[model samples]
Target: MTTSSMKRSQPFRSLVNRLLDHGILPTRKLILLLAGGSVAAALGALAGLGYALFWLYNAFLLLASILDWRSMPRRGQVNVARILPEQTDIGRELTVSLVLENHSGQPVPYRLRDDLPFSFERPPDVAGVLSAKREIVTYVTKGSERGLYTFSHLYLRCQGRLGLWEKQAKLAYEQHIKVYPDLSTVRGYLQSLQESLIVDGKKFLLKTRSGTEFHAIREYVPDDDPRYINWSASARGRRLMTNEYRPEQGKVLTILLDCGRMMGVELDGRTKLDLSMEAALTLAAVALRQGDQVALLAYSHEIKTYVPPGRGLGHLHTLIEAVYDLQSDFVESNPLLALEYLHRQQKRRSLMVLFSDMENYLLEDQLGAYLWRLRRSHLLLLLSLADPLLHDWSRTAASNSRIAYVKALAQRFQLDRKAFQQKMTGAGIQVLDIPADQLTLTVVNSYLEIKSREAL
Candidate 1:
């Protein structure tokens, strides 16, 4: 190894420290042997040379034990240091490493365990020999929820020269880390948006208006902007020709995130709450970039957090901070209560996009009144994370009665969801039911289309 690397590997504890780590059994054994020698000496006076030789034998054994103990490790400190990553994702596992240096000029054996904080999965015991150099030991922990956690100290134990004695030391280490929601999803989308719009692709973002304002001419659709349709172009193409409208901006967008018990259900290695957070963050990033004021409200039975309407790219950080440490509550959400609280905070009309489960709101009639009230005050896009397991069941071959029954049950759930969507749409509400993986794409596209159509 390199000289620098060699210097880093040192024993975690000294021989004297090792004695404290484990009992000094070798010394005690030697003392017992000495006591045996005393017994032999007493026998020698009563018997003869045979008993005298027994005493000498005892003395030899005692001396051997002492020599063996002396040969063991006895006098150096365990040079140890700790390392940590800058950040870790919420609900993901991370490794914490300890670098041990052997400063005793010899090999050192050690058993190490770190004092881990609550909510971490205790790492397995680390045991190995520090070969007259530096070595690293690591343990993994999964943060069940979110927020920050700390690692403070470690306990290291090693054996002495003799088999009976050992030493231990508590090495102080300080580290701080945060477990955050998966922000990469929003970051990737923002990169795509930047490349296509803000940097050098302004042409891709600007749309031709179809109104008397007279924007660029393009194929037409049934809309209010078509006051000046070109009759000559229509004749040449034999189709309706109209102008597309300029992109809309300066609207309010709000996300209602459900953090009730049903959101705790796991999908694709993440909880439904995680999927909802990912979708909400991506949408917020897009809306903020479009100059729309964005707000967030996390709710279960009551309001968890409410961020008032804000705009600009910098506001995305505020949205992330508001929801980064959010988790699901073991109770059904009160959407009516959430609505009442939101109205109290801001009465301005906004685009309200809700991320929740359809199962949580099956009682359509009881919720219809509250939902309609919100719909009156704001445009609603109620999105749910689709259950792929039910879709899989729908496509599977039902060879047996049990299999058929399962398929039937899956069909019923899908039908109920469809009925619920129809009911909402009939009341002029927008609903999107899609898988978690498709949420980012679908929500962004829908918002863009709504803006282009000037629906909100």
Candidate 2:
């Protein structure tokens, strides 16, 4: 949390009367009048007029402050509860709610300020009224980074009727909020796919092209093959319709996530792993919706987490949980270990996707061997990010010797990576090396193409 909270919660009286001792909150009209009366008393002491007036004025103002402070709601007469999100997507603004209940049966005005994490945007001042018995206040803030965030303290002040004194209290309600990489982009893609399927009138688990498996019936589209048309259903519906086929269930999809040192490198202000996370989610969600069993293995030097194969839209949640908290390790990754583990656990042929950084893979002598071994059984597809900075450096016209040398080096790396891609393709492994910014869309399209070709 950004702000330091008080060591212990003080009583409402101690908090409200704080302005009376060692503070300047009460130094307004009443204090000015008291100061004026004191000067008059000193000056008129010879005339014997303002002495009584000074004491009366001071006593009256003191009595008023005391009365206003005492009018505040006592302990147990007011209850406050905070509602925190279960987990928030990193860099997304989400609303936090507060339920303020007033048992004092009077209209109460309140000011609430939540102590948020340092990086998260602090919410604006939340002030409202409990018109009857309860009220709810909501404020939005964005979590600027991933990991666990906490909301430690609630600075609440209940105003008195006269507004002269406020009963301030620090409510200790620390909430542990998990900030995961933003998955909204992936979800949006998935939603789009689902909506398209509906518009095409295809069922979930749609089979692409020619297939023998029994699927549902749907309204015919212009591009649908005519051989699969159901004559009776078309006649009944009075429109041309086709028999939609669902592929034989259990087309296996395996995702191998690398949380290695290179994956931790920042691109476009976000780590490579973060972008890969979204791509992985998009693949898992879409494949699962298509009746494919989706599994994931997260690894760096060794296996960190593994989610077993499962199908259906609900299994997407399992894949998300398995990889959501994964952080990139600075150590070198061992895709060989992942291949070995999958070889033992997965006995069937599957479509495997490996997310990694290939910028310097050609320099690594042993990078291709692990994936080559996996390609013997699995349909291995290697996915990696293309740094936009490299494109800039490669195309930039160098004006001096230093920039010329830097551009030369950049071009060399780019050619090496291209050679590596050609070699991987020669080995029969599909390599989708794309810009980091376009990962979600490209990955989704590639997967659909694979399914469309019945390559599963």
Candidate 3:
């Protein structure tokens, strides 16, 4: 009704009128009417009046169709706009709305379909009779892939006044949305953030250790350490009080993400790279919350993305934008190149967490030396995803020759992975080989442990 909105709809209305001029399709009502008329003509033929009755019936049908077409409302009479969110997370449900304004004065029977992205489920057609001045229809959709997606062209069909034909129109409306990794882990952490120790899906009171920065002084509980009792504060407050020390913060954490062929392996319907990105995001959130500067480097055969060290919640948004559309490339990862680049750009000591495939690192024989040298300057942690299938295969009973061979191979791979982990640990490099589902928790805990130990 507003002048501004009416002006905006004018051009689209004109476009809709042009598009609706293409064709008209007969409706079921018209078809049924034709069939009944044919039956009547057959009966008239048996009565010896076939030719005249047939021609009369044909002329009547033609007249009805013409009158119906003239009385029908133009497709441009209804103006529609799609409302969509600018961004959403993978596997998260979102609501899409179609806002329709009817200016035709009469009711319009219409059906609509939106051109959704390939990763989204095809929503059923929307069919209804619009009699109101304005109406809004909404549908739920979820994206399975993480990337940018566009929705274009809303296909609409409207029935004529006499229900004889349906006019079709293709209206152009484009909307672009970015799909990011799931943020459930980050949200859960924030909800229970007051609790210090999170272990295996459980929260526990933090047992502050000595030789750390003082966090706060709280009323002493039975579980409070006797050595941490604040005698002066206790006397002044007339109650037992203890000094709580927290891990030192303001350290730099560098997340080295490997988007290569190996990371593309699928597990539990999600790629390893997807899982890694989620874990990386969780770690970055935790570190940034602790007032640590977080940096990100995503690379495959070459550096795909690099976000310099930054702090605060704003930096987290920067990281999300840089990697939300990143995909794994079908090429070998060059850790050497990544390390050299990091060395050149960064000179300060920081904690380097590498999210990569263990097999890929093992295959690159020359990567060890570079990693060892990098460890001397920065605390290096390699986080790798363990395949559950391989673990299951290793435990399967060797009842047949084929089973025995598979079990042997699995065990061999496990042993090799374990030995490599030990070697890295002995060299003062931390490593965590966790399952896809457990990566977020394990990586966060490892970072916390390293920070507590003041390793960086």
Candidate 4:
């Protein structure tokens, strides 16, 4: 072996020597030999012959010690490769794969305990297993915050015969995984919408009306525009057509998210704030694609993140990154302050989308005035979470006092939701009360519907 190799092997050799010198290697064998020799000697005494037993005991002890020492396994070399997804979305499961290779020529039987990042938990099945080389697959559900995650160490335990002793070695491997705001579903929806606009001729604009911005003019029909009628051509028996106008481009869209105590409540597997953020990201993406300049604001008692009105793919990236790490405050969201901030920031008329749980008590107590002020300039759309678990519980309740109590609570919450919707509608606000699973889809549909109406 080279000098460097010998130097590297010296520590383990010294450890083995120390163990041998302390009699740890053969203590059990020594005790067994001694006990057998004593019994034999006692029997011999009764028979008046004792000298041979002592020689036999020494021979057995020597043999057993040599065997035990030889049976102990050596620590093997290890290599590890880690695989992870390129990017992960919040609230979705991401899989990480670990492959281990053993370099030792001997078949080293060892147990492996991979040290995962604190943010992740190992799936139950992987909690057990040991080998020289093995593969472990683990999953972690992404949280609201987006950032880089690193995994660093793999621990190995080597067992000796009889399971009396083990040698542990820690191997170091470095890897990083990037987490980004989820946008795949939104991109797919936009692609579908673009296809529909391109292939469907019936939905295409045919005629332009007065007081509307002219978009395009197609072949004239029986009831085509009179002003665009080319009267001289009509006298010549030729068809006439009018121009069609789509709403002027550059309409502003504002998305407001409420990150407050109500949004902090967890339902199913994620907090309401998490669902809202995902929905907001989807809405922003769709709006930007539709030629509308989009702005975003996240607020509770105070502003958390705000992206001023902008258009383009770069703006979308900026907005997503800005809100990725935002969290809900424990305090009640101040709707009055939020509206005032909106008014000050937005100078032009815009379509404003608000995501918040508009519980009746909170709205009546704190937000009534702000709602009035917001309606003057912006076309407001409010989106709220509809708790499915409460609905299911109410439907499945048993006929007992305990169940009756739960039913009453569910009914009250439902009534409160209704009141909240009614109040917003009364104030001319469009509201969407959707379940968590449907929030992204609902938001996308709303944007499309608005686009079709030429509102943005």
In order, candidate lDDTs are 0.76, 0.78, 0.86, 0.68
Question: Candidate 4: what lDDT?
Answer: 0.68
User: Number of the top candidate by lDDT?
Assistant: 3
RMSD of each predicted structure? 11.2, 6.3, 6.8, 9.6
lDDT per residue as tens, model 2, 1-456? 323344344465576656432222432445566677767667668677657756776677678778867777776677778899889898888889988889987777777788888979986789877666877889999887777778887877776666665666767788888887788765664667443432123233333644557778989999788999999999999998898765566699999898989899988688999899987887787888777899999999889999999988888877776777789997988777777899999999999888988853564577688778777788988888997887899999999999999899999888888888899999988887799767766776777767766677
User: Best-fitting candidate, measured by TM-score?
Assistant: 3
Candidate 3 worst ten-residue window by lDDT: 202-211
Clash counts for the predictions, in order: 27, 0, 0, 4
Candidate 1's C-alpha lDDT? 0.76
Over 1-456, each residue of candidate 3 has an lDDT whose tens digit, in order, gives: 999999999999987777564457788999998888878789789989967787788788899999888766785888889999999999999999999888889898888899899999787898899889999999888999999999988988887678888887788999999999987777676566465746446543333463388889999999668999999999999999999887777889999999999999999899999999998998898889888999999999999999999999789899999999999998999888898999999899999999999997778898877788888889899989997978999999999999999999999999989988898888888777898878887788777767767767
Candidate 1 or 4, higher TM-score? Answer: 1
The alpha-carbon lDDT assigned to residue 151 of candidate 1 equals 80
Q: Which model is ahead, 3 or 4, in terms of lDDT?
A: 3
**Cα displacement (Å) at residue 82, model 3:** 1.0
Candidate 2 wrong stretches, greater than 4 Å: 1-61, 105-107, 129-131, 147-152, 162-164, 174-180, 189-207, 211-248
Residue 241 of model 3, lDDT score: 93
Of the two candidates 1 and 3, the one with more favorable TM-score, higher being better, is 3
Give the alpha carbon lDDT tens digit for every residue of 1-456 in model 1: 898765665454355455554434433545676667767776876676666667577767867666655655553556778888867777678887889887667676677888777877787888888886788888788776666778888777765554444455666787877777877666665677342433222223333351123346667677634666777788899987865445556689889999999899999778999888887887888788767899999999989999999989899988877888788998888777777787788788888888888887775356777888777788888889899999999888999999999999999999999988898899999888898877777777777767777777
What's the distance in Å from true for residue 195, model 2? Answer: 8.4
